[model samples]
Target chain A: MQRVPELLVEFYSRPGYLAIIRHMIDTLCGRLGFTPAESSQVCLAVDEALCNVIRHGYDSAPDGRIRLAVHEYSEKGRLEILIEDDAKQVDLDTIRSRDLEDVRPGGLGVHLINEIMDDAVYEHRKEGGMRLLMWKRLPRTAEPAKANQEVDAGES
Target chain B: MQGNHEMQVNTEQRDGATIVRPEGDVDLSSSSTLRTSLQEAHESTEGKLIIDLANVKYMDSSGVATLVECLQLSRRSGTTLLLCQLHERVLSVFQIARLDGVFDIVPSLDEALAH
Candidate 1:
């Protein structure tokens, strides 16, 4: 049996590199049973997490390293992602999403992750830096309704 | 219709509004460029500033933040800012943030121009 594909990558914390990561996640999510819209949200969540790592964890230091690991459990219909940065650790409690009613420009990254992902948590890595663990509930199959419609059309 | 070759966003003055259009993905790196364009549009236009998102297929939180900043700037300067032609995907980001109500969103450039 072919094994499930996993993504384990480490790269410098740079804004330019985010597009590559976003593309990877969007493609992987689509192949793993997410609709295009769902894939976009998942991709955005990951992008926002990486942005946080670069902005808050690394203090915009381009030389810092960011480790990203993505795992999938097809049977459980879940996708797990871990984003770690080798920069200053954060106080987990302080990483709160801004109040949406405030109508502001900044502080929406954490809110987006929490809104899109099924589960998201922040923790300080004992070794150094901070780690963000995120979980997304993947669809068991991509566009079941469309598949049913196609089958129905064929039978008729 | 005209564009800055170095940036993803293009700007044009049509009717009474300065229309700023950004193509492709808007993320951390591109949001700054988008912000600059929006700010300039707001500053140069005494009538209205409209952002046409017809070509923007993907946008992240940073892009949303940039728009919010532009909205605030437009309000502060007494310039009317409108967003039009948002893709369903890009529009969802604003809906998720509940910003759909905060900005003046129109269905097309004509609607924005009319507003």
Candidate 2:
């Protein structure tokens, strides 16, 4: 409900766009006070989600539309992003990641997203698609330069 | 071999080890290319394929999955697989996924080769 900066990006569901999307997420996280490492992890989470949308949601169709809405809460130092796809919706009950003990490929994407993000919610869009919302609580170092009284107040 | 400018993979042979160094961010976009490069490197030698990740600044689960595939392939081929010089960010991904326990990680190429 806070007044936050919101940005929406829409692109084709394709593997080639993953780099651009990752860079965008990383840069935005950095600018919003997330440390490089934090930004990188968030980048990974978003990348994983988008990859899922492009792969599973669209079934690797490449032409399916994908939309990402990023909400930047400057006051609270929290970032929330919503990923939407126009492909067929998936059952939320099946959103859970596979067991790590499996030690296999192709299923780690969902696990990585769940581990990196503080909160992740999946929903079926009314228009017939899937929507994923994720948010993370950043470190106190969210402020690059809080005040002269703050020293060694770096990211954890 | 390079993959769409997002990632470029380099391979080398040393001490009966095939070292694959991927320079760039490995994600869904470039992981397939990396897989190809790794597979080719492993095919060229009976060595322990060493994934030298010093140059990789970032990697996604897809990248990790690609490595997992190679690990399975190496096992089928009766070869050992090792990862060296994983950057902190990339290392954390493996750690989070508990893959660190599954992989033989080394600090450097020399150590990987020594093994």
Candidate 3:
């Protein structure tokens, strides 16, 4: 029933915030006992979401604050991350995928975000801001290969 | 917030490869450095262009997109572009983007040098 653990942060939407996000995930997941692959996926998805805010929400102006929260739902077997910014709101529907064949150098953040997370959604907060809600289910069992290895070791 | 940082780029032609060495993070703020290095290498060399990312500890979609641009440029200019020594986090970015298949990724500088 503990779906909302107290995790929150607020910072300027600057490029440097990327590293802070990475470190936060590492520390939080370490405490939660996440597997390496799960930790990596979460880190990547958070990066994609924050990068969108930094890129589109602020429009590289660096004058607004980004509010980020991570709620660990241990009982529900899921983790949720929410990112919001008070700058010029991004109309998420207007976002488009870059032509993979064109090989250009821009506009692929949304695609990466959609690819990494289990459920990704964007909404316009009633208070005039852009909010991104992302959720993923934590695996209920240990990796089969690792579990098998542990059993084999016990037998030996 | 991580401290503000800049990127340094270097280009050298050795053993039939144009090696572009960039030192620093490759997020939105610093991808321009990668662009400059890749462009400089392509202009100067008619051979393969190898991007040595050994010193690059961080990168975002902007950085990977820059590499994709460089790959396209290499194709148009008839030069091969290779990426080597990608740090684990940087590699993870590529994997999430599903771009690992698009680039010639090698384990080390020596392996890239041979190709």
Q: Fraction of true contacts reproduced, model 3?
A: 0.57
For model 1 chain A, where is the 10-residue window of minimal lDDT?
A142-151
Q: What is candidate 1's lDDT per residue for A29-130, written digit by digit as tens?
A: 787788888888988899999999998888888999999988776566788898988899887788988889999887888888899999998888889888
Model 3, chain B only, scores a TM-score of 0.93
Using TM-score as the measure, the top candidate is 1
Q: Residues A48-106, candidate 2, lDDT per residue (tens digit)?
A: 89888888899889799998988765456677899988899888888888988987887
Q: Which stretches of candidate 1 lie over 4 Å from their true place?
A: A1-5, A142-156, B1-7
- Model 1 residue A152 lDDT? 52
Clashing pairs in 3: none
Better of 1 and 2 by lDDT: 1
lDDT of 2 by residue, B13-107 (tens): 88877888999888887889999998898779775788899988888888999999999998889888999998888899999899999999999
TM-score of candidate 1 to 2 decimals: 0.89
Off by over 4 Å in 3: A1-5, A96-102, A139-156, B1-8
TM-scores, each model vs. reference: 0.89, 0.88, 0.82
lDDT of 3 by residue, A1-156 (tens): 223333689988787667767768866665566766567657767887787787777787676888888876655676778888887776667865665655566777777777767878888988988888888775665122333345557778
What is the Å distance of residue A104 in model 1 from its true position? 0.6
iRMSD, all candidates: 5.1, 4.0, 3.5
Query: Which of the two candidates, 1 or 2, achieves a greater DockQ against the reference?
Result: 2
If both were scored by TM-score, which would come out higher, candidate 1 or candidate 2? 1
Each prediction's DockQ? 0.42, 0.51, 0.40
